[model samples]
Target: MRDLTVAVFRPDDERLEDAVELIDSLGATAVPDPMLAVEPTGSPPRTDADCVVLTSKTGAELVADAGWEPGEATVCAIGPRTADALREVGYDVDTVPEEYTSSGLVATLEGAVDGARVEVARSDHGSPVLLDGLEAAGAYVHETVLYRLVRPAGSGDSTERAAAGTLDAACFTSSLTVEHWLEAADERGNRDEALEGLTEATVGVIGEPTRETAADAGIDVDLVASEATFDALACETVEAAAPTYHE
Candidate 1:
């Protein structure tokens, strides 16, 4: 079996459960860290926009729960998972880019959103790429803060494991996860130690923006997953740490 210990920072929920299961399936031990916690703003997206965009599965679910009705509006999602979430909530997704990142959504919608009112509904820590790209393309872009992601209490166990050099790999799904991981380390008075140990481990991020954030924070990222999916990130990080899975 693959013996690598991979650290993953997802909210302690079904997402973390899925990640741990996926790592186990690949034969790699999972070091699950609950990092992001969703605090909904109770603010729904505007329904009168020409197009409505959802960036995460949580955002899609939140908006759907708010009963956001998209009347004569194009529903855009950044990835298949989010699109699937929207569809599951009885919303018709009109556009999903070939690439799952914000940059990809920008590229896919830039040509068509030149004169449209684009509504981007996501978490507080969302990247500026989508909003900026849409605005640059001449769309009147409005951002709706569906939720704010905060670090959960008692969630830095993986940082201690990282500092101890026990982690063979890490899957960072968002920029906030990377930043909050280091913050947790700092609070434990092992920031430098954790960072040093992290350098020895294979690091995988969800997309280019996360890679940039990690690199800027002095964490050498090993690879950016081909897809912006947790399964892709976990598997890629596992492969980077242990090229061949045993047993």
Candidate 2:
């Protein structure tokens, strides 16, 4: 298949099945092998936090799973996708920045931090920018790890998918996914081959920071979404890959 294949760097768990199917329907193969594990700690100590911050769909999904209602707190999401996820479960998203990242969220947090209590729901590998920024602004910042970024023992189903040669491209949504994919492939003794395939294949990232990480590792990004959202990413991917087959 000359059509682009999108290796979804999400975990092979059942949670992402819908997304995989959706991508596959676009005439692209979807390979799932998560570089991160989302761990829910249930509801943490909810303080008098004036606002709630979400960094990813994982964080928003964790909030949805906790079944807790926000009480007089503003909800700030890093991007439109995270905000949509939060809103899907009846959480009102109060802020979404044009640029998507914890650092971007930190910039927006400065003005809002005055006399406010803020809590961040994010992964164990979350950046310190948001937490540090809020603390510096004199807002009490609370945070809990809702996930862990870890590599698997092997390539998982991705290796089989790769060998099929239907794969044309792969999308790395986060830095952890890129790192963990390499780490996991290394454990399987196919690290070099995998790296070669990834490098030769069309590589797409979700945003600038992730692109920086991939580029630093010598992977050139073929495409990046204009907006940092799943819908945007998927659309951009399909657009980027569509021209190769349409001719």
Q: Name the top lDDT candidate.
A: 1
The weakest ten consecutive residues by lDDT in model 2 span 156-165
Could you list the CA RMSD of all candidates, in the order they appear?
1.9, 3.0
2-103: candidate 2 lDDT, tens digit per residue = 446677766656546865887877777666666666556665526467888878777777767776667888888888878888888788899997678777
Which pairs clash (backbone N, Cα, C closer than 3 Å) in model 1? Answer: none
What is the C-alpha lDDT profile of model 1 across 88-169, one tens digit per residue? 9999999999999899999999999889999999999988888999999999999999999999988788889888987788
Instruction: Report the C-alpha displacement of residue 69, candidate 1, in angstroms.
Output: 0.5
Each candidate structure's count of clashing pairs: 0, 4
What count of clashes does model 1 give? 0
User: Which runs in model 1 stand beyond 4 Å of their true positions?
Assistant: 244-247
